[model samples]
Target: MLKRTRKHIKQLKRSITQSLNTPGRPTLPQDELNIIERIRKAAAANNQNNITRTQAYFNFYQNHPEVHWALLAHLVSRNAGWNMTDLKGEYLPKLLTDQEQVDFFAFLERGNWLIFQDAYPQLLLYEESKKQKRPLFHLLDPLNISKFMKPFWENMWSNERKEELTIALIINEQQYIEKRVIHNTHYKNKVLDTIMFKLQDVLDFNHILIPYTTPLQQKTKLVGGTVHHFSSVEDRITLGKGLYDLLFSVQSRLTQTVKWAETNPHTGSRKDYWPDLFNDVKESTPGQVHELKSSPCSLQVKASRIYSPSLPSVWKDWEHNKAEPGDWYPNKKMFHFVKQPIKQLSGDIEKTYCETIEELEMAAFTKNTFFHKK
Candidate 1:
């Protein structure tokens, strides 16, 4: 009986090991796991933002006892080409009322949008000062485009929708005030030039309109398990073009400003060694021989006859041009220029993505399914 019981335990252990070793699901990296953890935690909370809504489905799967299996089954079916029609008699539909499902889906769509935004971080504007020599500030996102479009997204999934959704892209510029004093540590000039560098008020706030429209008159089905519905190929392409133009416009302005800052000539203090002839000659008496000293003041003692006006042009130039300021030079090394997007340009950014949704759909379907092959 002891041997039989041991054999039974071994068989159970083998089964468990086999289940654990099942393939298909790739192991997530530590960073991705951390992101997922944050997502799950945020979704589990009563209050969740537009970004955490997709994760709430998983939260429900883990916490909701009776509705868990129903949600899982529906997810599997949807993945296998079954639309929302497969949700019949599911506990998920019963527990989460119709309106709640709509709300959840809306947040899910917004969450996907947030993911795109996070992928392309905001641009960093670096201050070109010694004291404040770092990323000064970031522009955009103050307009809050995602939050602004939330109200218009209500009828996005509706079968009957009329007007085109309008979105705004705003650019707000900040200027340096030149307030903080910069001490010239490298310059050897006698005069200590302390320049103040500070940031000033914001200006040149402008906005552009982006209109989003769908070509489909019928109710479009949700794809890829997300709340985002399907639009026409032409419509998607036009939206892509508009976003590209908008982003390029903003980027061009930033690039031009940075180039100007880097290439523009600015007069600054620089140090250079000069002979202490002025103080040395004044202090030394004619009777005693003046010994050369190299302490606080660097000086070379010579016969009083060497100070004659008949000296070479080189010596005369050096003597006359001593303790002068530096000439104008480009301020290229002062600041760092990084061309990154502040806010994720609205809609599907095809540049960062592998292919457009239209291309993806075309690839998925057979030539006969849509129409004659091109």
Candidate 2:
């Protein structure tokens, strides 16, 4: 596996080098330029928020079902939405200050937004390529996508290597965000390096959940894995690959998960998946003691639902700083993330999540009761 990954990386690096050495832009026909303009417009339009981005991915998957990563991205983007709304949700406001919540949301939103803008155009261009019935990936440079991806897209078109294409995209996007979000000095201090972010790690908030329904059951069942070290590009890639396998390896999972996404549009609320445990509508008054009637995975028969707000309710759209130029493919060490086998993960996170919430609530209650004198 290591040898094969090394060879692949060598090939990718050579392609990148060649792309760099040959720098002049190729002249495109007016029709292709028009197609590119339309793709850019579509990407920008859908890049508004988590809801739009999630819907865009699902819609793209519907049109190009062969691109398995679109479905995976849609589900993962749903989790991103849930995570964004979580800052304003019942427990987090107690833990994070208003500014801190804003900072954290910006972090998540920036990464989410960046990925959509970068990947959506690629998806649209691929659609155009299918329409043109030829490889049009040379347009990738014009789209401002990383040269690292051009080789993979070319290979995907010629060889029809779907899994490789998926993995390549996973690597490309993770690396894309590594410097722009994870390692950005501002975010490093404001969000990633903060104690609250560490608390998120300790509380297992990094778990990515994919909801699917079984043949006999209409209720949603989650099947997803967690990424332990979000800062590491390699770990994110590994998590992405694992998720891709989990989603596509099982036919029923793919079908049912798509159905769940289609039936429940993403509103940036956990209620989209588990309405019994979560509600977009606030049921309890803020800062008031409410009875905790929920267990690990469910609420009691009459328990009030927990508040999980929609994205727009809390955060307006943000215009990000222009992405810093340069690609993140610097070494062969990245290949370690490429071909490794990830252990299959089970979706038993409700108990862990509930326990984390309880722990956060306890800490908040203690802080409020003792630290803040009325």
Q: How far does residue 150 in candidate 1 sit from its true spot (Å)? A: 29
Residue 73 miss distance in model 2 (angstroms): 0.9
Best by lDDT: 2
**What's each prediction's TM-score?**
0.17, 0.93
- Per-residue lDDT value at 162 in model 1: 14
The stretch of ten residues in a row with the least summed lDDT in candidate 1 is 196-205
lDDT of 2 by residue, 304-337 (tens): 7778899899888888777678766655466555
